[model samples]
Structure formats: structure tokens, C-alpha cells
Target: MYQYDAIDHQLVAERVAQFRDQTERFLNKELSEQEFLPLRLQNGLYVQRYAPMLRVAIPYGMLSSNQLRTLADISRRYDRGYGHFSTRQNLQFNWPKLEDVPDILAELAEVEMHAIQTSGNCIRNTTTDQYSGVIADEIVDPRPYCELIRQWSTFHPEYAFLPRKFKIAVNANENADRAATQVHDIGLHIKKNAAGEIGFKVIVGGGLGRTPMVGVTISDFIPRADLLTYLEAIVRVYNQHGRRDNKYKARIKILVKALGIDEFRLRVEEEWKHIKNNESTVPAAEFDRLQSFFTEPEYQTLTDNPSNLTEKLADSTGFSRWFERNTFPHKKAGYRIVTLTLKKAGQAPGDATAEQMEKAADLADKYSFNELRVSHEQNLVLADVQQDQLVDLWNDCKEAGFATPTLGLLTDMICCPGGDFCALANAKSIPIAEQIQAEFDNLDYLYDIGELDLNISGCMNACGHHHVGNIGILGVDKKGEEFYQVSIGGASGHDASIGKILGPSFAQEEISRVIRKLVDVYVSQRTAEEHFIDTYRRIGITQFKEAVYAKAN
Candidate 1:
């Protein structure tokens, strides 16, 4: 929501122009594929299995209705008539031509958006709770600080080329919508201490791959003002000492593991002594300037429950079903947080059509305050919708193919666009997701399963955050055959932890049955009030593995 200032605008324009020239040179043969790799990556371009792919940044997953409309336009005009929203809350175009990238970026700049840092070994997009300002439980809105990191990390000269890609997340809410701050390269949970001073409880080096590890807490409290300074120290230490010889071993998680958390903390503290409150730390004036961008939208006064809509829903079970599942609490009275369900049973998860996109934009304009957000779970949010208009909104959404009542259910899956699109993927993920959805078509069963985040990725890049789902599935290719791997005990929000691998990979045909077994294990092990994640953590993955893997073997 931060509007670009003159300097911000100019900087982006210049970057666009620079990328345009770089793209032109690459297309003209002035730059080879190898030569253009890093340049294009810094601009969020990737040469995928088919054509080139471009990822556009939706910083912290917040977008205005104008931005959404712009995205729809870009998808229509630039590539195919659609774009893939990625797990990191960014958008990806699978068929972008190298020659057209510059123009694409120029268009994005006009909307105060860019592709910078969406990829590459440099600091990638700084993510935060999508419901930051609107969520009732938040101690403080984390976007201002996120924007501060955006400024400090953007094209930072010294840290521009790190050994591996880095990710950072900020979660201010106790519920941990941003995940438990667990598998990110760095996670920041913004909180106020007993003294009522704001600071971050920093987690470092948790990631998933061939070697997966939970991030260790490095600092109990990093004073709010010195957040950037402390972050710089962490990255600098990683940049200087993280394994550079082997690309596979280059993430901060590896460095933290090798040095051990105690020594890593000590080293970071020593480094922080010099940089703790340097120029990079966000000053008070800039913080206020950024905060102004997220001012609350105007709303009309109304009752908590509207009689008319309640009466209508009272008659129709269908309408009530959707209202119950898709709606969440909003900070404002008479306003509710509406999640537009992207999961239609048997459909590829999180795939929205162009018409669906437009309908969302229109709804954002008509009912919400011309603002929309994309959740990490790959769903869209109309953060503030009036209670009176809920039924009408649901009807319109239903007509537009946007009304599905599967929020936080098994159907509401987090998935990466796997082998169908991403070259890095080892197997196709969408079809597997469809198969699982088909197997568990009973809504009551899924709802009874209760708030399970089932995530899948084609490979270990963990794009779907397969590492943190209640049921995490990773697709692996064994020899010439495609196989799916299972992990359990993963979670993203409030109590984030990377899932443990269940055992060996399964043939693609066995995936659905494996999932069924995992679910049955949960049903048997869980108590009255425990969610899937709570049950998984309480009992551990051993029993689940015994149920699913032991039989398969």
C-alpha cells in the first residue's frame, strides 16, 4: 500500500530502464544465456521448462484493486490470459518472452510495482501477515517495518549477491498467520516486551530441502529501531561464511548448522556492535511516512449482525455453508474478512480464471474499500466486507466461479505450479492435488478433519511450503518414474515448524491412498479439540508414518 515517493519512483523507473536494456542486449545476442542469468534473475526472470517465466512482486501480498486490475491486464496482454500466484504471495507468468520483459517491467513501474528481488540469491521479497493492519490480534502493524526492510535490502550494494536465495517473514499476530516464523531463512515475530518496548524475536536458518532444519532463535528481543541493523549483521555473516563452494549448501540454514546456534548468535552479536543503529536502521520520520500509506479505509457504521442477511441465510443451508467457511473476523464492527475460495473440488488448487479475477476486483471496489490481498495459502482476501452485503456478495461470487466454501479445509490446498509449468519441478503437482481432492470429496469429512493445511511442491525448493503443512507432499522423480514424498507435522502460522518426512517416496498412483492413511491416523490419534497440526505435534510423525509407510513397504 506504500505509494512511491519521488526517489522511490525514480529508482524503480531507472531499474526498469536498466532491465529493459539488459533484456534487449540478451535478446540481441550481446549477452549469452550464462551471462544474462544473474541479471535476469535479479529482475525476477527465469528460463523455465518451456519459455521464460517472470515473477512480479506483490510486496507482503498487499495489493490495491488497481494493482489487481493491472495484474489481470498484464496476464491478458503480455503472456497467456492468466498468471500463476506463487507460494511466496508473488505472481508468475510462465510464457514471457525475453524481448518483452522490459516493457512488462515498465508497465509494472507505472503501478508502483516491480519484479526486483522476487528471485536471485539476494534478499527476496520481505513477507508479512497478509492481514497485518486489519487483523484484530496484532500487537502492531508489521508492514511499516517490512517496507523499511524493502528500502534497505533493495539493490543493496554489498549484499546484492549472496551465496543463496534468502527469505524473511514478519508475523505480528499471536496466531502466527505468517507461519510459526519457522522455515524462513529469517523470521521476525514483532512483539512488545514487559517494558512496552517494541522489538523482534528473531529466528534464523530454518529451511527445507535434502537437509531440513528448524530455525534457531538467535535473539530474544531486537529493539524495534535496530531491526535493520541486526538483520544486516545476520546476512553479512552468512554472506561471508555461508558455503559458497557447493550451491546446494549455501543457505543460511547450513551456516547456522555448521557454526551452531550459540556461536552464530555470538558472531552476530559481535558484528551488531558496529552496525546496530547505523544509517540503514529505519528513522522515525521514514517510519511515519510508510505508516501513512496503510491508513484505515473509511467504513459505514452498522450492527455486528445484519438481520436481513441472517434471515436469508437462515433459510438456505447452501448460503450458510459458504458464509461459515469463507468469512473471518475483521477489526471493524459490521465488517468481516472475506476469503474468496480458490479451491473448487476436483479443480487445480489456487488457479483463478481471468473472469474470476475481474469479479474479485469489482467486488473490492463495490463492497470492500478498493483493496485486495493474496494470502500465503494461495487465496484472495477482501479484508473488509459489510455484514449486510454478505449474501449478495456470495451470489455474485458464485456466479463468477469464486464461491467455494473450502477455506482452511483439505480442498484449500497450498500448491506450486509444478512440472506443468516450472522447469525446476520433478513431477506434476496439480493432478496429484486433483486426485486427492477427488478421493476426499465428502465436505463433512474434510470439515471434520478441521483446519488442515495440505501443501505440495514438485521439488525441494519447497515452493508450496510442503515443509510446513499438516500434510506436506513433495514430488520426487526416482529414475524415470514420478513419485510423491510425504511429510507430516508441518505448520505455517503462529506455531510454525518444518514437517518431518514420513519415510520413502510413493509412486504417483499411491499418493491418494497415502493421504487417506495419513488422515485416518490423525482421526484416530486426535482428541476432542485438537486441530490436525496440534495432534501431529502432540503425537509426532512416527505413528502417522507407521500407518502409511510401514504398510506400503
Candidate 2:
């Protein structure tokens, strides 16, 4: 993790003081609700259904042991004894008092963390692969670029208030895109040209909310040095021309759609010509300065498959299953990246209790080089766990209720805090997620079905990223009653696609059965070794829709 320098420290301290004053003014009636809206939002404070929700940024989803402990302490003292890890790789405290948020900010500042750029209509947190530097399949570490963007975009004077919130994702891995770059406002796919020079394959206009669109490749190749300048050009074009009349039509995706990719590319190119050679073009010194922070940790030299690990896997089926599902290949021979699932049965997805957070911090310190990562799927990662220590770590995780061994299964769902907490939501999402999890509790059945991404959103805001799920579920309200809408064939990766709706919505109670029918259809239609999404794409959603509705009819 990058430790804050003196400038970083001072900047965050000043911002905290400023927000404290702003909050005090609002509470004292010196500032009205409308007047304080932007101020509070800029500080990552949202007025939810019942109370204020404070979103704290985990830059590129990286965290240190100290930072994790600080978050756990914040959860224990300020809000309810838990915090929700969001789909954007941020953490949200759902019940923080409005007056207490400044103090919370101050606490976060002590640990080199903040809420800045986590909310409001500005450049949000820049996320990347959770296994950025450690994964074997990466082309280059994306964290330095993500960090550069974070620093560049933070309180940027020109882009403080864009037409709408903008998101950016960077992917260095050629095989998989865990960051789901294709669905972000700006997706940077790091690649090497024919001459072997590094550059980005820039994709623009992708988003998920009301109007879902996969990004179009605006530039086939932009040199690494020109990344920031090119990005500035794109945002400047959007800021100058994007719609301000309607909130729904303000996102960069809408502007890209209206202008067409060709015209949009032309405008950006024109803007880039003015600044491409300027300070915005990252200098070699700056690249070295940022890259120095993300250099590989000191790792011990050991074999890829240690005798102890092999023996343990051979002896215990439980250990083998957990290893197969929860762990990922690492670049280092002796190490593995482990995902500690937050999706326990009966618990809301991504909601980690204070105790669990503290436990995770301890575990990270003890076994994983004192570091952790927040995955886009709303799970935590120990990116440098030793292969030989897997059993002990698994035992500790099992004790803490995180050893689910259902990483890509149906039970490991991505969900949002819907109507229960969010004012924007039309229907409750947690109860629905819980019901589905309960219905799919059988591990044997889930394993037989293979990998499935089931995402649920409260409404069309797509906070759960329901648009990209293999089996997407959206909660809808029908005459004050909550109904669930189902979609199929959506995916998020190198080949991302928005899910297609499968006819009418179902009642909350009927949703699990609907999902079961959809799964049954997949099981019956799928060829050997085919995943749910593959089968859905192969056979199409028509049969699944028919099966689901036939039961209802």
C-alpha cells in the first residue's frame, strides 16, 4: 500500500476541517438542505432512507492491517457494528449520525484514508484488479496507473462537478478483467504494441444504470505517457457538451451515445492536441515515483507445490474444495491469492461485522504480508498467502465464518442495500438475496451447477451491477408491493454484456422458485463443461423464460 506523503496528509487534514465546518453549519441551520447537498455529497455522505450513509474509499481496493483495524473501530464506535463493502470496492457505513461524520473523516484521515471522490458527480475511485501485481496472468501492474489517476482526479478544479458521476477502471490482465473495465465510463486496457511499447486500448461510454452500454474502443492505442492528457481531453469534451437539463441523460455514456464514437473521438483528439505534450503527459520521473510504491514485497523462495500443502489437499476433501474455489494462482511460486467470502448464509452480502473486520485484519497481518484487497464482487482478498500455510488460514477463516468455499457459486451473490436503506430503491434487496441464498444453500447442488454470478439490485441504479450478472435480479415495486425482475445472459469481463429481461416480474416469495426454474433449464440444456452464462448464450433466454413463467401461469 502507498503511504501518504506530507502533501497528501496536509490535503486530507484540510479537507476534513473544511467538511467539519460545513457539517456544523448545516446542523446549526446556517446552511439549508439544498445548500448542503453538494457539500455533504462531496464528502461521501448520503442522506439515505433512515439515516446518513458514509462511503469511504479504498483506493484500488487496497488496505493495510492498520487501516482495516481503523475501519473496524469506526464501525464499532460510530455506526452499527458493521460496514457494507460495495460493488465499487468501497465501504459504506449505513447508520452513521450526520454530526459524527466529520469525526469519522478525521479518524479515517489518521489512517491515510478518506471519503473524497467516493461520491458526488466527479471522478470516483479508480478501481483495478484486486490481484493487480500478484497475479500470474497480468501484463503489467495496474495499481500505479490507478494511483496516478486517483491523485490527478482528486478535487481537480476543472472536474469538481461533472454532468454526472464518472468511473474509470484499469485492467492489465490479458486473460480476465476482474475490474469489469468494459462497463465503466473510461476503461483502460493496458497493452503492448507491435513495437513492444506499452500503451492503453481506451474504451469509452460504457455504463450500467438506466441506459446500459458496453464501451466502444475510442483509441486503439494511446502511449502510456499520454494517458492523463487523453483522459483530460475526454472529460473536457464531455463537460463542455454533455447534457445538464436532465439528470438521467448526464452521464458520459449518454453524451457518447448522442455524439457517436467517431465524433466523440474527434473532439477528444482535438482537445488532446493542446495538452498532449504538456505536464499532463506523465514524465519518466513521475512514473518511477509512483511505480516505486507498488514494487513487489519481499517473498521467500519456495516450491510452487510444497509437500505439506499437497499432503493436506490429498488428505482432506474440505481443504481441497476450499482451495479450488477460494484461492487463485499467484505470480510467485510459493504464494496464492485467497478470497475470504463475506457472503455467509443468512447474512446480507458484503456486510462484515466489526469482529469479522478485526479478525480479517489480524489474519492479514499474520498470514498475508499485512495487506488485504476488496474485490469488485464484494469480497476481501489476502493477496500474498503462503501455499504451505493454507490449512491454518482456512481454519482461522472457518472459525470467523468466512470459509464458505462458494467463490463463484450461486450463493456468493453480489447485492445492494436496496429499499431497506436506500431512498432511491423501489424494493428491498437484502431479504430477496437472503431468500435466494437460503434456497441455494446446498453446496453439492451449487457445485454441480458450476460457476454462476447472481447479482441483485434494489432498482435501476444498478449498484449491485445486476446488469452484468449471469442471472440478474432487479427489485421492482408494483402498486406498493415489491416484485423481482429476472434477467439472463449478462456478463462482466473482457466480453461484457447487459442482461436481457425475461418477461414479467415475480413476487418476492416466488423469486427463488423462478431462479430454480432458470437453473433447471440451464442444467437440462447445457453441454458438458459449459458454465451458466455459456449455456444461456448457447440456448438463449427463451426456454428459461418459458420455464419460469409456466410455473407462475
Please tell me which predicted candidate would have the highest TM-score against the true structure: 2
TM-score of each: 0.96, 0.99
Instruction: Report the number of the highest-lDDT candidate.
Output: 2
Q: What's the residue-level lDDT of 229 in candidate 1?
A: 88
Distance (Å) between predicted and true CA of 121, model 1? 0.7
RMSD of each: 1.8, 0.9
Q: Please report, in order, the local distance difference test score of every candidate based on alpha carbons.
A: 0.85, 0.93
Which TM-score value belongs to model 2?
A: 0.99
lDDT of 2 by residue, 39-128 (tens): 999999999999999999999999998999999999999999999999889999999999999999999999999999788999999999
Question: Model 2 RMSD to the real structure?
Answer: 0.9
Residue 262 Cα positional deviation in candidate 2, in Å, after optimal superposition: 0.6
